[model samples]
Target: MKKTLLAAAALAFTAGLAHAGDTVRMGTEGKYPPYNFINDKGQVDGFERELGDKLCAMESLTCTWTTNDWDSIIPNLLSGNYDTIMAGMSITDERKKTIDFTQAYYPPAFSAYLGKDAGANIKGVVAAQVGTIQADYVAKSGATLLEFPTMDDTIAAVKNGEADAVFADKDALKPFSKAEGGDFVWAGQEVQLGEGIGVGLRKSDTALKDKLNDGIGKMKADGSLNVLLKKWFGDETPTF
Candidate 1:
């Protein structure tokens, strides 16, 4: 009886160790500006990168970042290449089908941009980035759709008259428009497309999910999240 009790205690201790030291590999499309872009220094620098660093510190876990194309991020997560995703991904009902989301850390909304010479009559018809809620809205709202791999390409399509307008997140459009010599205009009111952005994790890892949620909540309560947001948006709070 004594031997059995000792062995049971040893097994429980091993299990606890396994849970405590687990590493989380996070994936993101490092090309989206103001969120997960690769800077000129050849390093990832953006709101999501900063936020992920904070979460890792709070959770007392080792975190790693890997870059992939935006379209492939979800599939890579499902295949277990990464434990979580922080690619400025919005929490939507459609995405919730495959992976679980942590508490939202950033707002999610869509804005439209038009070229200087584009007609206002083409205002309501525009293309949005593929695999986004903006694309879904365009499909349902009778807008013509032209998909692109990056926001820069989408904006260029409008500027060159290949497409009349482009729809994407406000954070993305704001910087692009300012840098491009004021060639684009924000059309209509910005659309609140979904809930805030969250970390995507595999459905089987409920323990890690809970850990991340707690860490994010702590970041918010301690003002770390706001600090990162201001670094990206400069006095504007991200809208969900």
Candidate 2:
């Protein structure tokens, strides 16, 4: 879900290896809701938090969570600030070249345009979170792309008429579209981008990657992943 402009810089930093029984640090953006966000008590709380905790428990690994800005989430992991990225990040070929990913925990989600004008699709000024796949798509679609550091900023741009529309995950935009006294509406045909969301790790952390994959596989086999998806995203969301 990010651009690779800092890939080389990230690659330059090596992960400080962690051994078994050590507390594996999980990094997240703590902004994207349903996936991750800071709760009323100012602690990490959301679907990813619950899922990550369960995964760690099942794997017999001690884990701790930390929050980072979305744009630098991957770089910090490579720099040894965190062992894994549990932010709502999509797995993409462009990203895979920079970091290793466990099997997807969330399936590919559709990107939608949120605005007051229903006819607006890819045209006019479009707002997107900086370095995200939605931003990349808008940049390539010949639309005027306004990049913001956070998802909230993108929505603000649309609300304030700074942009014609905001392109983001449909799930991310759903609340605004249905918000009481708000006029937000879907402005485009939904488009699917990237593979899916997953746990991002440094390429050298193969053991950690394998362990996460194994746990994810069990979750899928037991239908627990589906339960979590529906709990956060509603029954309409797809399952494995």
Candidate 3:
């Protein structure tokens, strides 16, 4: 009886170990600047990366990040190709139907960039990259929509007069606008986009979702979240 009880206890301990150290694969579009972009050394580095690292550390889980295109990210997550997504995806009603999201990690703000000759007639003008929230806004708002695979291409389209304007997160647009001298200008006020950014997880993975949220709340309370935000956005805390 003593030996049997010891074996049962060992089995339970092994199960707990398996549950605690589970590895989570995170998906990201490594093209979005200051969020999850690829560095010159061919490594993924950005705000999302830092946040993911912290979450994994806090939760005692191993994390692996996979870089993928923006359009296929959601499908990939749903297919179980990854365990979660830390791609700075916003929590939207449309997406909530398909997957669950953790508490927001960053705020959302939208801005538009126009070419030198382009006036502020944003109506009917093509703006935003494909598969992005800005593109969704353009489609729903009856604006002429132009889609590009990457932010660089979208910026190039505006600079070369191919597209009238490009809309994206304000933080992502700031560096490009500054580099353009008088060639480009931000038009209109920065619009409050939505309820910040969050980690996207599979709908059935409620356990992992709870863990991520708890980790985020701890990060917020300890000021680690703010430290990471300042590293990426300088003095500005993005509007959530």
Candidate 4:
């Protein structure tokens, strides 16, 4: 993993979707393990949870978590269903058109292809979460794309013989690949894409954006962010 801080985006999104609430609502897809998920306790839990909590504390903001399906996560944010999107959402110019993003907390990592056969052809059927960059890639790469409403379904497609493989953030898919034993392996070379993940806020909420950025800057300076990244993903993922 390359150790670096992704630059802050010089942009704003949804200037009309301003938020005013006592509690910061952090929306997530609670299925991306190591990043965000519902633990055995049934509460929102994972690396982002810990990091979001820390960031909220830094800004002295009260925060609450909401789990939503991945496909509608961004639209929900725009609709004021939540105050911010803290899922493992990568910062991209396309997404920047819909919502503003903070400087990346996690640097961009590789997009991995996982499958039952190590020799699966890249042109074979590929499964990816709907509305993801991975899905878009497969659609344009000549591979038949089988879009799922969630990440779990994408993996299920590969497991159920519906897809030759699943494509997603390498680190986001690490736990699944490992848990699949030898049934699934990294089928092809990894591809890195987009800016890293960040906290997504409405464009009108620059105040909230600055506070979160300030918190992230403090964590980067004190090495706390690095510690959390290492804790969740080991030394394999890039850190601040």
Candidate 5:
């Protein structure tokens, strides 16, 4: 839910609805592990990839996937580069002002601190991915914020001692913290942000948005969404 200047043509395009059965393009940042990431085969693979496919099948929509850098994700959608954003985007009022969202597919999860240090230095330098909720939090917080273009860079900042800690979605950082022989550790209390993760769409694609919402509802009702959540995030991660 970040970045980009909307062109006038893009704003005008948002007034038109997409035709049914048109090929739907699913946009993602294929760098965030467990959410959307490029697999060994150089194809998008992750929880969202699986989830999006299921939703598409349920809705009977022809779907395709594409990757974009996180910073321009929303703008690309508004400009019609993609039909939906399946990136790990949260539902927030600030983001809602720019684009509409389908109902949440993932539940609200905590953002946590990771570092070599034992506890977080709240007022010290903290690293977060640029244009993320965590970055916005550190900016408003008393801490000095160190922004990076990617999630991996934020962890690198902590590793290289540029920041006291990296704050990010706890699930996104779990593999690092629990890695064998890794030095990173959970540094502080987990902070919750946003409502939950959802599929982002242009305000004009009300039809697609409705189809996605209905498919998500079906998943939730049948417990299939929870299965995906557990498969990616472990049972300890909350379910719908």
Candidate 6:
């Protein structure tokens, strides 16, 4: 009963945003757990969701959440499907060519190779989500890179033996690796990647960008950002 109510509330909260004042529609890929995911209540929940909400509150802005497939997240944002992206999107020079980013919310973390064969060659065929930094890195790693539209498919490819291993954000693979028991293990050295995770907005949205930057400054000043970061990602999540 409680779950049902929460689900209803989640739907209503998100669906009613069009009627709210100063609503900022946030775009996210909801499949990445611990970052952003659809919770048991069918609501957007996780680190970014929490942080986005707090940031909106700080800026005195109303906000709503929408989930878009990772592959189309940026395009959809460009199409006005949402106001900004709160997905676990890294700030990158290549990506910056098309979209503007706010100050990084999370430091650039490392990517690792995961596989069933503990002894698999790091140079073997590897899988990564399409268009991600991991995919970009794999292309230059002398490994046969297999790209998938979503993180789930990348992991599925390794489990189904289509790829020798999967490379992605270390933190993203943590829960799955822990839950899979001894099935999957880290197979190679983790490579540091990207500048950090940041909120993506259209390049022309300088007003909104400045507002968000100010809100981020406030969070950092009062230490709420670090508090939420640790609450979701634990003590090791870098804070500055």
Ten contiguous residues with the weakest lDDT in model 2: 11-20
Q: By how many angstroms RMSD does model 3 differ from the true structure?
A: 7.8
Runs of candidate 1 exceeding 4 Å displacement: 1-20, 117-125, 178-182
Residue pairs whose backbone atoms clash in candidate 4: none
Model 2 spans > 4 angstroms off: 1-14, 179-182
lDDT of 1 by residue, 56-158 (tens): 8788888877888887888877766677888878999999999889999986655555544434434455766778877777677666778887777787787
What lDDT does each candidate get?
0.76, 0.87, 0.77, 0.85, 0.88, 0.85
Model 6 C-alpha lDDT versus the unseen true structure:
0.85
Tens digits of per-residue lDDT for model 4, 136-208: 8889989999999888898889999999999999887877775644457888888888898899988778888
- In terms of TM-score, which candidate is stronger, 1 or 5? 5
TM-score of each: 0.85, 0.91, 0.85, 0.89, 0.92, 0.88
- Residue 72 lDDT, candidate 1, scale 0-100: 83
Q: lDDT per residue, candidate 6, 119-152, as tens digits?
A: 8666888999998999999999899999999888
Q: After superposition, how far is residue 93 of candidate 3 from its true place, in Å?
A: 0.2
Residue runs of model 5 more than 4 Å from their true location after superposition: 1-20, 179-181
State which candidate has the highest TM-score. Answer: 5
lDDT of 2 by residue, 131-177 (tens): 89999999999999999999999989988889999999988778778
What are the per-residue Cα lDDT tens digits for candidate 3 across 17-129?
33345788778889887888989988888999888988988998898878988878888776566778887687888899998899898866555555443365566466677
Quick one: best lDDT, which candidate?
5
> Which candidate order results from sorting by TM-score in descending order?
5, 2, 4, 6, 3, 1
Query: Which residue pairs in candidate 6 have backbone atoms (N, alpha carbon, C) closer than 3 angstroms, thus clashing?
Result: none
